[model samples]
Target chain A: MSLPEDYLRYPLRRRGMDQDRYEWRPRADAPRRAWPNGAKVAACIVAPLEFHMLNPSGKPFKHPGAMQTPYPDLRHYTTRDYGVRVGAFRLLDALKRHRVRITFAVNAVLLTRAAPLIEAITADGHEIAAYGWDTDTLHWGGLVETEEAARVDKVRAAFAAAGLAPRAWLSPARSQSFATPDIVRAAGFDICLDWEMDNTPVAMRTAAGLLHCVPLSNELDDRKLLIDQRQTEEEWRAQILEANALLQSEHDRFGGQTLAFTLTPYVIGQPFRIWALDALLSALATDDAVWTATASELVEACA
Target chain B: MHADPNLYDYWPYRDRPRIAWPGGKKLAFWVAPNIEFYEFDPPANPSRPGWPRPAPDVVGYSQRDWGNRIGHWRLMELLDKYAIRGSISLSTALIDHHPEIIEACVARRWEFFSHGIYNTRYSYGMSEAQERAMIEDSIASVEKATGQRIRGYLAPALTHTERTFDLIAALDFWYTCDLFQDDQPQPLKTKSGKVVSMPYSLEVNDVITYGAMAMSPWRYADVLKRHFDQLLQEGERSGVVMCIPLHAYLVSQAHRIRPFEEALRHIASHADDVWFATAVEIAGFYREHCWDQTIADIDRRGLARPGVGFAP
Candidate 1:
């Protein structure tokens, strides 16, 4: 695989000053260096499942071109909602296997429909957070105009069914509604994952009150990773490893600053992709300093 | 189950739109000149000897090839008329393949937010290492093309996974326009630290509203003016921000160019109350006034604070 030629450049001009904040080591020593002794990093592993087909109603029925038509039952392509089901099952298994907690950033529509999955996430010592609903429609509609109460109810009901409550919510596709914090706060979420403003978590204003906004990223997302071409199994593994290294480096650099790694089952849920992810997780687990926790753990700790 | 009837009801929803701090009066318009191209190079698809053409799915066989569609000088002139500075969300490959389009964006002093190497390159299933390289490549392409440091990023079609947040933060972008959080800009949390989701509105975008449905220039201009009026009124009461995304190919089309022209005229008409600027400027203003505390909290909580890391 030919690496994009531009990847070698350092200290990019636009954000060079900012990039300098995270000191870069030569490639030779990059893998071995650990974050400073006192340093810490908060890592969030999120898997946003594409759960639309689950509803038995939402499917990509319309396409701009000759894309294969989706089956009425959604069996033609990956069952629209099947990914979410697998995601739910996988979260439960992963939690059990790793014996660590996690957070499921769910879109509202799927939250209600994917009841069993939501329950598994909560039962496995993880957190359930809002990921917005109807990604494409929501993206077009913008967050300002969403029905706050309805949104809150859908999310709350989903969590309540699972005998849990989500203290924080992330917008669909990381898109926010100006009133998102308000809806979240009014609905009782104490924090949000909406801000990409910084690397660390910080307090942010919501309509209801000041909620903690933990900085999140879109870099590790499958949608971004697999944009132009589908990634091979080996390439996928490398991406995860590189991310761990970066986070580990930052953890060592800061006096114990938190870092997050987010993912979506729809992107990584494929059996082949999952195998690569599992391997990456194995490597990460070897690093004793890397503690795997849920979104709530990180948010609550920081808060 | 069908979508809630109320869900489709944009009418009432419009009336009860959440009333919060003024959305913002300042406008940061992004004109993403998406360029796509295709060539039926001889010996097409060596596998199929005289195989009645190319694979519709693999190789682009769409209406307008990206190459011919982007970097239209005529469109830049329209933006210039209103003194509207913008961020060009360019596909990195498009910039590399066609430097002229890059020149057109640079000529107009537009900022370039990388939209990935190519429109078709799916980032899904990419490993952590490949993702890092792709991001670095994208950043480099943006800088090389626009001669401007890309401070922001927008995902392709906004399709993304969870790992993106930490990765983006690690990269240290000032802001990313990829998300649609709210009508106004606010600080959202990321893995590394707090970053602002400089709120972007596709409602006012040319792609869906106009490009999908044929909208007359005057009518489209009216729509923008009305939206602007709403944001402006709210801004007068509290700080608010407005963002409008445009496309070069769509708006540059002969039939639709008038709306772009008229929109510029309308903005020019209200220059004083409506601050015409880039996405960065609006985000900066919000960062200073409407969102300082939010950003700070994200920063404090986002970083590893020794014993303070991880929630119970």
Candidate 2:
């Protein structure tokens, strides 16, 4: 829904903080003094990388029915040889080939299992972050099964085992617990990358505090356009170009904002998919206004 | 048919604050009960403003047309196609009439949650004991049909007596969705001091907001994608829960199924960032991890403190 005209007439308000007349902040760290005369965008390779023997192919395990033997393959495979290293390396190679900085929202389990790739992504200057460990997407009120304190302990244990400190987290499947922000901030993240208001950064305040957010536009995710069988690739590409063009325009209209595209390794990390991505990036990059950066870097720039 | 006045009031003061968890992400997933069309006695006048006028060739004992069956099957197809599972909040009459629907749900092992005997059968005027009997009877009927225990109850339009929770818990059901609090599941101490709320959402409920909102299939998908993006972004800093509630009947419709396909496909592809789970699984997770003294403490504070706050 379009924001009600009165929506702006009265500034958006949340408790504990008075609403401000919306003001756009110029970034001291933005590479350009003013976003070039066109729409500007920042791209982050946001991959929810999964690793585990149970979820080797990132599919849920199911009990085998009557005729089935001891176990059945309840898992789904995206590509052959479904190991974290093989898939992740392919992903790393693609991002590196594109010279894109990715924010690996590592499922803690996957990060631990795929240490080599985690280190490789880290070594490649891409950011390594948290995508909750065992709880698939959101806790759904089920984490440790008892106390919130125990739940905190489980998250800590998973992160500690990974040997990497993450300041930002992405919910599994975009799922969140109300307690997530407080828990994440308590865990020490300064920004959240989960908002989809517009293709610009907006500030979200929670009980923890004000966490800067990079709003994601749904138009960019390939799953919506291609995988869901809703649109053909040609149509999808046109939509992509159209959306990017619009964001570039919006950025030009509203200065100093960052636009981000969150891509999945399973979708864009493939060979043919890489081409579509390349075509889109090539087109956007030609515009001097748009620049691609890792999500963490954008977070740092905005916060 | 007048809308409940309670639906419009914003308990803004009750809006949850960002509780700070210093160690790890707090993730929550909600499994919502979407019961589309269970057999209901046709609208008394049959010419009601909000409902569809009955078709000319309507058949059988109920005099109901299965024009909506195509949509229901489509919903089934999509859920099966994606391997997405959920709790089917069912009306008893729907289960009694369409045993295959229950069979389909059971085949997928969808969580069986009660949604009264029919869409029209609210527990509104029922005595407390009657409400309890409905609770007991619903559980027995659903468990027998689905071959799985029915552990949760979502009142018709969230209608029920104050003792609903206690009766639900007393009936040995695991959770109830009569309340929408923080995205996490927490105990709600009634005056009777029993029964708790496992969070569910009207915010995320799709039938009224998306389906009846006349949102296009693309926009419906976009709505979910947008919410996913928001939750994931928010989770990056401090984790949070995102819930998408569906109704088998509404989303199963020809126009609405595409969004379901789009949403599940989008979410599944990002499997690493999301956990696709059933409501029961989520409830189990919350009980284990997020629910505790903090929640009980919040409940004990007796409405003064509002939503849970992390130990700042």
Candidate 3:
């Protein structure tokens, strides 16, 4: 049997991006800027502090680290919480030893549940950015505008209620609807780190105005390397160092390059894996060419 | 569906028809750059939906879009550096969608073969006429744009009907990148008498490894080198085809591209044994040299079905 008549039709096929969220600039043409200290590369490490609900909605799709077993899934819930409880501090101390300040993308739910943890992160001179409602409430394309807006507002309200203002936004799982950029911008976020389209920063032309985007490295993250890819910690460190070296060379050729990697406590913060993070930081420390900046600093310097 | 389609017989790897590439090179290496376009929203196929998230999967869509905008140029320049002409597995609608990309690839003398009109379209439940029209449209679109006759077919998004092979063969295509049972080009039993299953690989494919397998860039680089080494070693016995199918969306990220470039550099360094040819050239050489012997070998091994003939 044949398909429907309209199946072959190409309605919106055209020159540039199908959506108008951002202008497409090729790598040679993508915007780049010099680092503050004449450094060739800027490393923006994302420290994600999240809360995974026991019973995940998983409406469209389940997040990578979302609960896997049946209800009362304490096994996964506590495993993820271990990031906030024990692992984050271990990595934080290691980061301090390397003398690098990072951006902590705090899920809005964590503002209340881990209030002292958030306070401690701020006290230690790390910047805070807004992650979505929790690890489970992802903003997807099918989500209704009003429903998505309400969720977006929850991030602001949760942090505002805590008398803290975070200017950057990263969607949970980095999933986004067509209107996510517009909504996030209208809600007054200066920077968003969802799109891993490029290593460089870009100012997305949303309906609400310009929202600066700093791409997070989806491939180089700890969950991707150590967990998903099932590579050893040694392999993970090697991959990160290789990525940094690649970017460093590109920086030498071009203007400047950004090497952003995510350090999740549940994944990279495990007692066995923390040394790998230490090794990575120690290696970057020796490289005087690298300027470790917060996500905001990256947006300011590159965007 | 039968247990096996019985398209190609159980032809063993060893002592087959010897395939000698140009310059007596043992390995015919090709870069299959899959230049595809996925629709933001399209009428869903009864077989498979267009996207995972409801309608407009913004992250997935824009990430692919980044390939056309940013990734392609980076990958193209790297290929140019190695003097490797990409045998592009093109989504021909991109000919209309982004002709600048076409012009650039054409300038490098790249070979364009049909992937399909849009990658979003699948060949799962089409009438015989619909599949023909879809295939022909890609041929015409690519022909009109670059003035190159596409000699090969890769099913759009690799979705196919049972009749896909027979249909493509009937339309006078020289090669199909759809099959992966062999590392060297082999014959497909088509009504047209001689249609080659060009040695396009899924394992070495960037989308499969980088996206699906979640491979780290350097790990991917290491795999590429390892894959090439194995093929080069095997090529001495019988000429082997090593195809590295790349998608700009996955392979050409800033951190990723450099390692891929190094892998290419490593592959290209084996100048004597590795003959860098397009899919069409590989097919043409096979037809000229290896087809009759291969058919005879298949018959000698009792692998042939009745009434199969090589178009001599």
Candidate 4:
């Protein structure tokens, strides 16, 4: 059995990355900048308020924290719904208590559907960034440029409709098509939080212009730690503190470091796990060297 | 289709041939840091797609890129502290994409072997000739880059056709890290020449343990210690091999590195008991010492009888 002649050929094999969306700028070579307060670490906390549809097509691939059961998965539906409903308030309270200005990555459908939730988040004086249309919605490579671009524009338009200007964007599950960066840049956004190539913000070489990529690290993410890994609350806090310690030390030796991570309401907002979030926020506050900033503040300082 | 591959004969892991490593070391240890390069977008094989999501796959692509830009240096420095020269499973195209990494690995005198052109590309539906050309291209790339011939193959993304083993044997590669049958290196039973299946473990592979299994760092560190202790104890009878196949992108994260370091420190403490070696070195030693006896043992055991017979 044989295949096409072009199968083994690598068309995009080049000196730098195979794609042109970004350059292969190593972290070692990147200039390290100080945060606004002369702090060594920029603590960027992102909280995604997503809504998983009851019936998912599960195209391309099933994302983490998606509905696991068959149709009418009320079990998982309510589990995730709890995040936007009851859990988000607990998560917000913790951030508000610490006086930390966090960014809320809201889905497009959630903008119109959950107006009260949107108003609550906005009224709390936190930055609201763009998440995708919904958890099931995807802007993947399988989608054509026009379709993907429309999705980005649709999300941007929804943000405008809500009377809230989105300075940042994070894709649902952080999935993207080849045309995502160009589309995202064309939408007139300042930064995207989907690419996590470094601890510091990077300028993606988008055709629209240079799009600042503020990397929200998935390493110590609350959902990954508490939900996926089945790690104990203590283990989760320890890992967060441990990762922060490492980044702080790296900042001291190198120049700039961002301790950026995502906190899910359904995951970390659970009563048991909420204590861990409280402990982590308190622990991070104790470190005067740590500078907690919103996504826009981070990109402005680093990118 | 044949029920079995027939490439390797079934040889039991009981009392057979006893191997003694160099300097009478009980265990042979090697670390394979897969210095891989996942293309932003590659030609898709009809049987299998490349990225989990669609093309571009900004998240998947950037995560791997982070390894080269950030993780590789961190891992390289840690390995240097332990005086461990990693036998890099390289995506040959990375020789062009990132030469600085290649230069650094060369400076440390690390062993280089072919892991195909790009990790994203697979060897699914290819003419034997085309596959051979791909293999030849990889060999040529490594030779040109490092001024050294590669002696091992772990196919790109571990995707392969049935003819892979024989082709690699014909190409005169010494060993393959693809197989996971035995804890020790064994004759791969190739048609052309001697090719050994080095015990490149999938069990404790960081990609499996960390990525697939979603194991926490604390647990992984403990697993490493226990895995090493057990292998060391087993090696008392005959020599055994313990390979840690790693993806720099996964393990080099700041959160995971400390736990990994603790495990490495535990393994490195047994300097006298372990023969810190590379894949090729282990395969070379196995070929020179254990190849003949192991092949004969397979013959003697009647485990691989030529004539087909039913169990009934």
DockQ of all candidate complexes: 0.02, 0.02, 0.01, 0.01
Stretches off by above 4 angstroms in model 2 are A1-303, B1-26, B30-33, B36-68, B191-196, B236-239, B296-312
Query: How well is each residue in B1-312 modelled by candidate 3, as lDDT tens digits?
Result: 321344565454535667778888999999999999999997888867889888889999999999999999999999988899999999999988899999999999999999988999988788889999999898888888889988899988777666777787887888998765567777787766468988776656888677666778987887788778766866787898889999999899998999888899998899989999999999999988998888788777434555332211
Q: Give the candidate order by descending TM-score.
A: 3, 4, 1, 2
Q: lDDT of model 4 at residue A246?
A: 84
Write candidate 4's Cα lDDT for B1-312 as tens digits: 222344455454445577889999999999999999998888888867889889989999999999999999999999999999999999999999999999999999899988998888888777789889888998999888888799998888777666777788899999998765456677776667789878776557898778765788987887678778867866787898999998889999999999999999999999999999988889889999888888788787525545321111
- Candidate 4: TM-score? 0.51
Q: What TM-score, over all chains together, does every model reach? A: 0.45, 0.44, 0.52, 0.51
Q: Per-residue lDDT tens digits of candidate 1, residues B120-208?
A: 55455567787778888988877665567766766654434345545766787667665432344545455465456665555466765
lDDT of 4 by residue, A114-178 (tens): 56667767777888999978887887989989888888888889889889789898988899988
> Which lDDT tens digits does candidate 3 get at residues A179-202?
899898888898998987777787
Worst 10-residue lDDT window for candidate 1 chain A reads A63-72
Docking class of 1: incorrect
Q: Top model by lDDT, which number? A: 3
Question: How many pairs collide in each candidate, listed in order?
Answer: 115, 60, 0, 1
Q: Roughly what TM-score does model 1 have, to 2 decimal places?
A: 0.45
Error of 3 at A282 (Å): 37
